[model samples]
Target: MIRFERVSVRYEGTERPTLSGVDLTVPEGELVLLVGPSGVGKSTLLGTVSGLVPHFTGGLLSGRVTVGGRDTRTHKPRELADLVGTVGQDPLAHFVTDTVEDELAYGMESLGLAPDVMRRRVEETLDLLGLAELRDRPIATLSGGQRQRVAIGSVLTPHPKVLVLDEPTSALDPAAAEEVLAVLQRLVHDLGTTVLMAEHRLERVVQYADQVVLLPAPGAPPVMGPPAEVMRVSPVRPPVAELGLLAGWDPLPLSVRDARRGAGGLRERLADASPPEAASVPEPAAPPEASAMPGAPAPVVAARPRTGRFARLLGRGAVARAAPVADPVTRVDGLGVRRGRVEALRRVTLTVAPGETVALMGRNGAGKSTLLGALVGMIEPTAGSVRVGGLAPARTDPRAMVRRVGLVPQEPRDLLYADTVAAECAAADRDAGAAEGTCRALVSELLPGVGDDTHPRDLSEGQRLALALALVLTGRPPLLLLDEPTRGLDYAAKARLVGVLRGLAAEGHAIVLATHDVELAAELAHRVVILADGEVVADGPTGRVVVSSPAFAPQTAKILAPQEWLTVSQVRGALEAGA
Candidate 1:
């Protein structure tokens, strides 16, 4: 029920248009997916249907966009609220009420719905989205994934005919993502609701799409067709599609079930072979400017980390014999954290050695973020102790803690304040007490094409994440913590980040990141630690941990089955080695 007629959008400052000559008609009661790399106008196009393009964002729109026979150009976002419901990238900005129950009811109140009708719809949405337990919780106190559900539930309560979602599952854990996607499926199938969604994580949503619209590049018109047809020509792809292409399958698979059904011959070919040893994090790359600066302290070049499978083997001795320091970089002992009436973490104990990479994984609100906060001195544990480099994180001075540990939270914007990228880098350098150009050089390495003049807010979510990571790494902290680190990054950007993080581990920095991307955990993490309900459920080598669990396994691991292959890289390595 959405139509775009020769639409093109251009902002005031730049010469190139964000979207060029895009013409498409979204059929009623179908789910349409918008796929592309970052900054390719996917978000801008979604804005057009909700009357946010020219009406709210102040951009020039050359063509017409209509939703359900109503012209978006003439009807502003407020006027069209009855027909459309939109949930943007950041859920915090979309919130107007304090509590979950209040937020869900506010939309219907504004539409002048009767009290009884609003109450019924609110209860249905709460049960459908699994937010009944959190109906009374404050929006500010919920985790990132929880906030995302509340935002979606708020829009859903109004019962609008058309729904527009941007990265709906990016912040959610695997099971939680599945629940939200299943709800969307019901709306599309049973209720005949129309949905248009833009997301970077194709692995989670591609198989559910009725039609796929691809924006191949900047200033390029979109290609529309079935999911498989468009994915063959698209530059970016999910792990299942990547594996299908690698195995020379006639038709690429979009889901694990499809890939497994055709993986018999490929698994036989690999039965005699073994997956490649997981390499240690690559040596950290030093900024050229920092090395050349006069009077700057020389960067420490630590020994390369232990070889294979993990930083060290999963059992017995995990710390390398050649490690520079005898003490662990960070330690948590019987940790317990309480937020209001909920126990966020309890009796959680873990340790990270020099040059080790660990991934914390679990469902939404599983205490992963709470553990990171304890390490970074942001939260005080109600019970137990937290130590970073022999100093208590909660008791240490702010300046001293910066050198010991650095954390990049789920909201990357919290760490950003400067107007321009250059200014942000300069401030990071100063805060880290490092060379003037240190942060910028790291930014250049992580995000190659980003300009210095670009505002942090102007950049897409992925670009903003890259810059925030660079800023945090500038300090050269002994321990680093990242929460949902790959929230907005595409595959290419994620590869670059993996390379950079590997190098840091090689330079003897301890890495602890909380994430939901199974592929990332398989590719980069030396060890996987699973948490559930504020307790560690499973912790071991990457292969053993992921291969045993269906929800936690990557596409490659799922397809290659009882053979224990975790990623496509390992499979390719076996093939190249004559297996």
Candidate 2:
């Protein structure tokens, strides 16, 4: 269905070609996974299949790309629309219509389909993608995962034989992302549609892929083969696969279900082995530096407040009055929020205490993001109330609330406006009263190699994400809210972010993160709040919540391993300790 012959594509003004001397082919109805690190041309290759490479992105292209036997270079995006359906990393970027129904019908209308055909296809796509309930909803009012489903439905309405998705689930929470993946599986199994996708969170999608295409970094050659074969030789791998290597499991496991079965026999052998002394085990290593380049401006130093204003406000100021109590820093009661006519939150109640890390999780349309927004006062709760530091979010002054609550939004670029890394950090310091040198050091620690002069916007997606986190941390808000902070980050970047969150939690910041990354929740969050269909279905410690949820239980390495392991180091430590 698709072919690239010695294809080398180089964007203008860049010295290196994003993809060079690439040879790839996909047969009809095959689900191919494109895997690689950031800036490794994974998206660039997907563009070729969709006729967005040389046609829309504008670049010097050598060699030929054929889709359905027609030269992609000769066909415009519109011309190839009948054969190719492409969804980008950002779902909102592809939204051209305001309502979900219109968005789905827009593509069919452009193709000049008959009204009856368009109507039927739209209905089919909505049902297929589980968007029937949201068919008439406004696209803008939908959540990130909802919008992404709409994007897929919009493209699929054309009834293209080949569907191309670029990091389709990167922005979704784990449950929501799974829903999207489930739809892809349905497409392959039920409709026999060809799927070509690129994603960073391999743990989520790698298990279900039929084939894996490993793209070489800027200076290396690309590799492709069956999923098992590709994973064996690939330098980067998911945790289960790595564990499979260590345990010498034949045909390494990709998903937790696979790993659990593979480990069943190994568990007996492991149990027979003598447990090593705990004191002999080394402590977990510090997280990797955040900046891409060394000597980058350090992150700002956050000043710890001498007194807890909330404690004082709640009449716990006197030493004699200080008693053992739950660290409730923020409280919510009967919280209700709405987006247009849809109720995002209805009679929601929760509390976040200082020195606790809570992860908010749910399906795509479950209102996790909306609840977080209400906590930070970004959106007003229509019927109930949110309290931040003993003051109502609606009544508290904006500046004071900002100082007490810092949020890292789902879209990192929303917060970044500076020309360089240093400027961004400097602006954060001025606003938060953070120490400049400390901010620089933190930036260097969190994201190494990002220099003071590096443009924030020009950095890769991972770098941009780290930059956003650094900016939020500079303010040293007592309450930190992170929304899908690890969406597009690679393994190394994710480790750094996880470590930072762990450190922040240890330092007494009440951190609430709304994310789809279950591993991250296990690693960093002390508690997990599971939302389903706009309601809290489960609320408990991380281990209980993770191990109990059917959706999250599949990725439960942290619970099985003995040591408090978050990163590879922790796992290695446990192994070395014979745990």
Candidate 3:
């Protein structure tokens, strides 16, 4: 459906082309994944198909692009609306209407489709995207995942043959992301729609891709092939694929189930092929009584339950300790916050202890972010007060407040400025007036491969998240706050992050984050707080809160095997132990 010939594109920048001599073709009814490290022109290539490259984003185009046998150069975005549908990373940014139904019909109206045709298409889209229940809801009231799905439904209403999405699931929770992917899969299976998507978290979508298109760094050529073959040799890949590579397996697996099967086969083969060694006439090594547990079978190595390093790091010190402080670190009494003319938070009250890790979860605009803002004094409460570390967060001095609490925003790049990672760490330390290299070790632990000379922007999204966490840890505040820190990270990175957070909690640093990832909450958080319409609906221990709640319950395995296993390593440990 789409073809690019010597398509070299460069913006009016200092030096290099974003995409150089990219020669490729995407056949009809194919689901192609455009993947690479951040800022590598994946989005730029998606734009070419939807006619947004040379039209909306002004750039030098040295080659040709054809879609459905029609030259993309001759058709603008509006003109190509019937042939191609484009959804961006931020669904809210591209919204043209206020309500879900209106948004879905907006594109069809623009295309001048008849009323009967528009009505039929809108209904079909609403059902296909699973938005029928929320048909009349306001676009502002939808969750991040819901909003993205609605954005896609809006474009697909025009019956575009090709669908192009740029990081559509970047901001969604795992369950919601899965819903979107399932819908796209159906579109390909039922309607024969051609899909081209760009995303950083390949682990989530790699299993669904029919073909994979990998774009190397700038000035480098692109690579294309089957999903398994391409990911087997790709520079950046998920841990499962890397493990398969190390195991010398043919056609690496994309998901955990496949990996498990492959691993089982390898183990069986090893067991069958190896012969037992002959007994040697040598003195036996003495068994150490110190290594054995009283009345137990030496701790049963195979029975050692898988535990998330982050969860252990956070809960390690606090598991046996009792609470010492009388008042909680943060206390919200009848809190309410307003944004413009709307009330975001309403009569919300909650308290977090000194050594607690609370995960606040709710749909987008459900008031989770608003409540966090009020707690941190970013937004003033309209009718109530918020106390952090015994003092009102609103009345506390800026420096004093910062010393007691640290916040890591959703977009960490908004706060990052230094040229190097080490320099950024140093600058944060200097501002806090703390000891030198206070957070250096922590940063190195989270990002093992990162160096002092590495530029923050050059790193992957997962690396940026680690750097942000490190920057926040530099202050060594009593409380740490994070906003959807694992949005774009893969399974391995998420495991590392959970470990870091767990460690912080173990060190007696209270943390409260607003997020939509229920599994992440189940694994890392000691407590879970559910918000709806800006009020605290559910709050308690993480497993109980998420496993029982109507709005926040996670998967069956996660609930059943509750050591808070957030990564594959944790799951494997639990499985081997029969826990």
Candidate 4:
């Protein structure tokens, strides 16, 4: 359905082509997954099919690209709208209407479809994506994940033969992500629609791919084959694949079921051994001397028990301490936030203590983002109270709030305004009153090799996120809140972020992040709080909450449980000790 013939794309400013000599083809009715590290042209490759690369993006296209036998060079995006439907990473950027129903019909209306046809297709799409209940809701009021589903539904309503999705499930919770993927599966299997998608969260979608396309590096020829074949050498891999590699399995398993089926011997070997000890929380970093930073509040110290160096290094100190009963860095009581007629958050209450990391999780529109907004003063509570470091967030001055708390929203662009990365970092350093190069140093640590002169808008989603996170951390806020923090980060970047957050938590900084990435929660969170219908439904230690709920469990937990294991690293640690 889609074909590329030695296609190469080079933007106006740079010398090296983003994609070089990429000759590939996607047969009709097939679901092809584009996999690669950040900045490796996955987005560039997807754009070629929809004619956004050389057309809207103003790039040089060296070879022919066609969809359904019509060369993209001869057809612009609008002219080929009937043949291809594209959804970019940012859903808000794709909307042209205020409400869900209108957004779904906008594409069809642009194509000049008859009103009857457009109406029928709009309803069908809403039902297919499970958005029928939200049909009349305003687009601006939807959560990040809801906006994602709406964006996809808008494209699917057009019934284009070929669907191009960039990070389709990046913003969705696990269950919602499964729903979207299942819908795509039906389109490919039952309706014979061709799908080409690129996503950073491989564990969520890798198993569903009919074929895998790996863009290993810029200017390198692309690798195409079955999912397992590409994953064997791909730098980024799902946890199941990583486990398979570690266990020396002949054929790597892409899904949890397959991994479990092949793990009989390993499980038997582990049956006699006790599960590896959970890491102990590290000692909270000593507070800065009162004279060092005048007027700064003293850090809240946790009375943690002694732990080993490894536990301290991993920031697992929470495991060694008794239940925390006091000194909450953030407290919410009967918090309720309303937007117009919708009750976004209702009587939601939670607490985060110093040196602890809490992951707030729920389905899309489950009030996770709303709670984060309330914590950072972006959304005011209408019927309850919110406190960060003893000050009401909604009423705190912006300058003082920066020291007490910092929030990195789902869209990193909202925090960035400077033209260049260097300038942004400089501004952050100056505003935070930190050392001149502190922000840049944090950026280099979070995202190495990003050029100082690069524009903030030009960085990939993951890189941009890293920059935003660095900007927030420069202040060393006592309490940190991040919404969908791992949207575009690859595994290596995620690991680095985990380490950074671990260090911060060890230093008595409370970290609260809203995320759909269960793997991240399993790795970094001391506690898991599940929100549903704008209220906390489950709250407990990470292992307890995630393992009991199938929808929230990570791949490793699903495979290794009934055993309480949550990560491959934990399994590896146990095996190493036994060996």
Overall lDDT per candidate, in order of appearance: 0.86, 0.75, 0.72, 0.86
Error of 3 at 475 (Å): 5.8
Residues 364-435, model 4: lDDT tens digits: 999998899899888889988998888998898988898999999999999999999899999999999999
What is the TM-score (0 to 1) of candidate 1? 0.91
What's the distance in Å from true for residue 554, model 1?
Answer: 0.9
Candidate 1 Cα outliers beyond 4 Å, as residue runs: 280-326
lDDT of 2 by residue, 79-109 (tens): 9998899998778878898999999999989
Tens digits of per-residue lDDT, candidate 3, 307-372, equal 477645444212111112234677676677876667787666565666678888876657776776
Q: Is candidate 1 or candidate 3 better by TM-score?
A: 1
| Model 1 clash number | 5
lDDT of 4: 0.86
Candidate 1: tens digits of C-alpha lDDT, residues 189-258: 9999999999888999999999999999877999999999888888878988888888988788899899
Model 2 residue runs over 4 Å out of place are 12-15, 173-176, 189-192, 269-327, 339-341, 419-423, 435-460, 557-572
Error of 3 at 546 (Å): 7.8
Q: Candidate 1, after superposition: displacement of residue 2 in Å?
A: 1.2
Q: Considering lDDT, which of the candidate structures 1 and 2 is the better prediction for this target?
A: 1
Worst 10 residues of 1 by lDDT: 316-325
